[model samples]
Target: MSSVWHARCAGLMITSLALFAGTAWSATISHAAAPAAAHSAPAAAAAQPAAPTYQHTASYQAAEAKYNQIRALQVQAFDASECIRKKDCPSDESDMLRPLEQALVLKRALETAASAGDRDAAYFRAKVAAEESARFNEEADIYTGFQDPAYKRSAGLAYERAVRERDFAKNMLVAGAIDLHPWSCMLYADLNMAAQPGVNNRDAAFNAYYCAASGFADRGLKDLALKAYAGMLKTGHPQHPYVLDMHSRLLNVRPDNPWRKIEPSGLVRQPATTSKTSHH
Candidate 1:
């Protein structure tokens, strides 16, 4: 579809995903050690001959038609989400469901009506994944390899594209008035599936702990936030800045903090509530 559609769809996608509160979608691409010998296959292929690039201009009309429909659905989904956010009650008539639920259900219908399993149908999903990945430096290089710096760059680009695409699709679904509540969950599902299983579980666990702490802090759920910080300390992350920053947020009111109660059990007591954290 048009650029306007692309932008609108993307806006909706981001709105839907952000609903998950403190949750995010992420993608990663890794560069591995190269083989001792250079990759000869690509070199040989390059030397053998050159092939013409297919523009697919001949298929533009069909692509545009599909793009336009997806675009419209995205708009619909966005509107539905607004209703859900404002606490409009669902009356249970055909017209009243959370936008997230509607978004997913609607998208499924679109997917069915369109060419089944068509690569085009996934265009927006791919874009969202790509964007989210780029934020953390992962990109996709579909035709490239981990061996080339260009491959890494391409991979990052692809991931960024995927993130953007996914966001847009979900947003569109939400706007269209589908089960909007689950849109974030759905986006997360896509994101987690695309994430690296993680070579560093220790880091991941601590990171999650701190992340939860941050959310609780924002929501004034200080007790829960402190407990989260304590949970991370239990994991013994060596108090890196990432970990310490989280603790610092608790120093004030810490004695009053729930975690400090464990001091009798030998947990390091957090300082008094009147105290403040300093960089020193």
Candidate 2:
């Protein structure tokens, strides 16, 4: 009887231990599985990025199309203006008024784009305004140069009107320059020069070109800055000490400038180096 009781007690203890072990194992498995599920959830979410909606895509595509259309028109107007300027196509000047009319249209479009927050369009519009002003000024001169009294009288009035419009172009040029448009700054500098007859303001022209050169240099456009610097030299002011110093400084900064290198006269000379022989 005693042996049978001891055997029964041992069996009961073994069964209890097995039950406890099974419970502990199930808890461990549940805890590990929970962490894995939590980690996988964040990982899965992180793998995906937000995508553009249909409306965004449509709006972007529309803007791109409009921008491209305006660019094409601007290009066409630019080419036509070039042709008119060169007198390569007199017919264009007779009817379509290649530069002024087409440029005016482009100007308006560019203005609209600028108003809509397009900076490049504003710069382009400023350039067109400058071109229009120049063309008008030229036309005014041609008309005033007419030998006939009747033509001269009418053309003189036109010339005065053009001069007034040219003032507006100067304002546009200033606007573009303030916006840091390099080409506009150049045109502005040129317009302010005393090179044209009856317009003598050497001081103003020199200052404008100097400012442009400094701005371009600050923007890492050393080449363009060099051009503006050269323009200062072109102003009978080449002998000025300041001009000479600036030119020398720029040459030192850019020894291998492509534009300057292309000019055979501006080539820099290399100094000969002599080596000493050592006798042992």
Error of 1 at 150 (Å): 44
Q: Mind sharing the TM-score for model 1?
A: 0.22
* Per-residue C-alpha lDDT of model 1 across residues 245-279, encoded as one tens digit per residue: 87677774545553335546576667768767799
lDDT per residue as tens, model 2, 94-128: 34344345545656766676667554555455545
Task: Return the lDDT, model 1, position 109.
Answer: 51
* Residue 188 lDDT, candidate 1, scale 0-100: 32
Which candidate number would show the highest TM-score if scored against the true structure? 2
Instruction: Give me the displacement of residue 200 in model 2, in angstroms.
Output: 3.2
lDDT of each: 0.50, 0.65
Query: Which runs of model 2 end up more than 4 angstroms from their true locations?
Result: 1-105, 112-122, 178-181, 194-197, 236-245, 254-280
lDDT of 2 at 56: 24
Root mean square deviation (Cα) for candidate 2: 17.1
